[model samples]
Target: MMNKLYIGNLSPAVTAEDLRQLFGDRKLPLAGQVLLKSGYAFVDYPDQNWAIRAIETLSGKVELHGKIMEVDYSVSKKLRSRRIQIRNIPPHLQWEVLDGLLAQYGTVENVEQVNTDTETAVVNVTYATREEAKIAIEKLSGHQFENYSFKISYIPDEEFVGAIIGKEGLTIKNITKQTQSRVDIHRKENSGAAEKPVTIHATPEGTSEACRMILEIMQKEADETKLAEEIPLKILAHNGLVGRLIGKEGRNLKKIEHETGTKITISSLQDLSIYNPERTITVKGTVEACASAEIEIMKKLREAFENDMLAVNQQANLIPGLNLSALGIFSTGLSVLPPPAGPRGAPPAPPYHPFATHSGYFSSLYPPHQFSPFPHHHSYPEQEIVNLFIPTQAVGAIIGKKGAHIKQLARFAGASIKIAPAEGPDVSERMVIITGPPEAQFKAQGRIFGKLKEENFFNPKEEVKLEAHIRVPSSTAGRVIGKGGKTVNELQNLTSAEVIVPRDQTPDENEEVIVRIIGHFFASQTAQRKIREIVQQVKQQEQKYPQGVASQRSK
Candidate 1:
């Protein structure tokens, strides 16, 4: 049950004070002021019994300024249940006393204990029927049981269960972990029915946070599941925050597009609703690209939210028609909406293969990766390989005792990691061949660099720089080198990484040869991405015009 009632069919002559006088005459007190709209209004009735009475007595019964009034719950249908919660039961209260007290009003179908971190007890008491529960609430509420108060609150307990349990039960688990709340998805009760009632058990403080997270997850899944040619992600931000996201003359938006390889567009001003006041930001790209853009966009939004919070706090209404409670801000006397959190509660990453299945450039044999909601930290999930060289003496630290550290790194990165046999005794460097997707390569390489710095492999305050080698098709070597070595030089300048291609190198059995990259982790990663892009261009060129490629090769 909700306290906010929608009051409609009001005459233009009726003022908020007129409606207030009517409720006041009926001994009803409002939790908040009436939000007056055109010929209608919305007001929060603090108590459910009072709200029920207001609906019964006023809706289509009373005349306000010669117009019949309409009053009803603002919450959506079927969200309510035949359950009422009783909190603040003294710890010493016996079950017999509670049962007898509950029996006085209605038939007790079931009662579930709600876990809390306090001495006071709480329970979800489900009556035999909705009518019975209604009676129980009306009669037992504000009544003392065993000389103790049992504060009653109706629980609107269920929602769309699918969104809460995301890809492989990951989202609900995250809510459990992050909010310290346990979510029980009761799927068996109504196997074929769409509406599944889920239970969330948590302390009072964490309950709101968990509810907010579940709502967000549902909102996101609802937006992205539309049947479009390309799946486009739409983010709704307050109109006041959109300007900062786009930046001065759209620099921020442009930067995000270039960095993430996505196209972003904002909804037209004409679509702005006085009630919503939100602008829809449309981002189109691969899921990975959109994921990256989402992070950046949310960062900008959070910054604006923090700065605008002060101004919103000082004012009574931040957005004239917006509801602060709906935005998860319930601060007393202040109506401030916090920043939107990015898509969260993705599944834990897939486990790593200790041994490489597609070893040494054999990715064709491996199955395509399944798309899942996963964490992205400035890296993609496309399959890749990197041959990272570390100091020979430092290899012990990299391997750790009995190869434990390397195994841990592989697990964390979801990659198949291997250390190559040293070329000869006393060699200056040893090779660590990392086989995995792009994100794994990023993590494994990043950690290796960090470990080197931590172990004093580099001077204190010195950047941990290393050489990384990757193999590319011999035919694309010239394309990477370019005419007069222009492409490689540009890559070097752009990424601040050294790119070297030794001339007249014999192609290996796979018709591929080595391209060495030397720089810090970020620089090397950028250089590799650029070089691989050139390789892709050459491959596409060959596919389109084979004879032309042959002629160019002859030149």
Candidate 2:
């Protein structure tokens, strides 16, 4: 026994000064020294009496950081030196060979070869004195016997032993084969230590390799235990399009699962209510596998979205007098219709020009269509606009110190973004307006969403939900809502957002009705873009048939 007490379960914030103050408050005599660690500490006293008193008084009685401290007398480490356990001895090594090896260092009073399993054994060589055992350990700890290197260490905790052995001893067998080392975990016969000594028998290289393998396995087990307590990744997707993501008879989702080794399950249709048309998609796997699955899932969803957009565009094209140019549909320089034939024998409609004046005035509200649907490459940046409502508390994180973060974000996203002032003193949220092409919108809005998440605006276990508002002509609201709400339902399916055009709402000065979109950042942005397209279509229809519009207005 030593005149020192071990103090465990200490808070990291506890300092030497705090310890001294605590001792003073308790009226305990000063200790000789204090050795502090992350979550444990050691204190030396002037004599054994003080140490004993400290243990009696403080053990399980003192509290720090919500944990009761564990105090006990320090055990003398020197006592363990006499009992030397030689590990990682090649299984083929006869008992005579091991005996001869230990004989060189000291008189081996007792040599017990405890067979832990068929392929591994531990030899406990107890010398007559501690000096002999120490000498043997120092000289032969790293010595190579055949192809196995010796690994010598004190016993580990019982938990580590259970982890090493695994269920039905399968883990140890795998580790033995992988590291080419025989691992022997001794059973504890006394209460001196919570765990028995584990020894490895192998070549010097194999001994080190075995140690690494064991540590890695232990770490993996710990990580898995922690993850078991965490929530699975829940992705909200539109109820209608989730079928597309699942593929024809769940083939798409099955393929993603096979490739990524992750299990995915979507919420049942019964879970859907008027408030939440989106279904929750739960992904379960290790972090890396979950991330891979997310990528695959999103890829399938994007493809579905592109196809849906193409279908919608085709439908819009059939509406007589719909100006694709005014709607910025041909900004990608793709010809939706052949150019008009020149007067008389002139060359039939000169080759299409990208900068043709007929393309109409480009608006920042909607980005130019520089890329075709599923284009292989984007040569020029196209502009897009998105409006976000962020909690006021999280705005500082997005802005950073003196606007450094915001400036960097603008440059990185290649977009012009601004945060509007608070509407009033009571408002808890502010509007973040972002203008950029698709890539820019992705970067800028993604950063804003990420910033809010990092700042803990939403619980770590929950997905971040955001609201975005866009304005469209009141007349276009009918088309957006569609006949019997079919169009809005399709938009929600395509974007995975809750689209609400409040009924009988008064229009703004511009005769525009506000469409409220709510969902995760990506879903809300997608819904906004789709609604803008509908607004553009309505504008073109009004321009094409003024007489028909007037007649409808009169009616």
lDDT of 2 at 217: 56
Residue range 1-555, candidate 1, lDDT tens digits:
124566778899888889888888877655355777676677754344455556556767888888888775442222334567776688888888889988887789677665555467777687766678778878877778567766664543332344577657787789889978766654443221212334445553454456456545644543553312334445656565689999999999999999999998886776543222356676667656765776677668757765545332232111122222221111111011111111011111111100000001001111111112222223333677889999998999999999999999999877888999999988999999999876567567767876776576875334568999999998888878877888788778767789998878999999998999998765776677677767767788989998788555411
Residues 282-395 of candidate 2: C-alpha lDDT, one tens digit per residue: 666655665466556656654665565565444322222222333222222100000011111122111211000011111111222322343223232446556789888888
lDDT of 1 at 397: 98
The reply for model 2, stretches above 4 Å from the true place, is 1-385, 437-439, 549-555
- Give Cα distance to truth, residue 488, candidate 2, Å: 1.8
Q: Scored by CA lDDT, what does every candidate get?
A: 0.61, 0.57
Clashing pairs in 1: none
The positional error of residue 337 in candidate 2, measured at the CA in angstroms, is: 54
Worst 10 residues of 2 by lDDT: 334-343
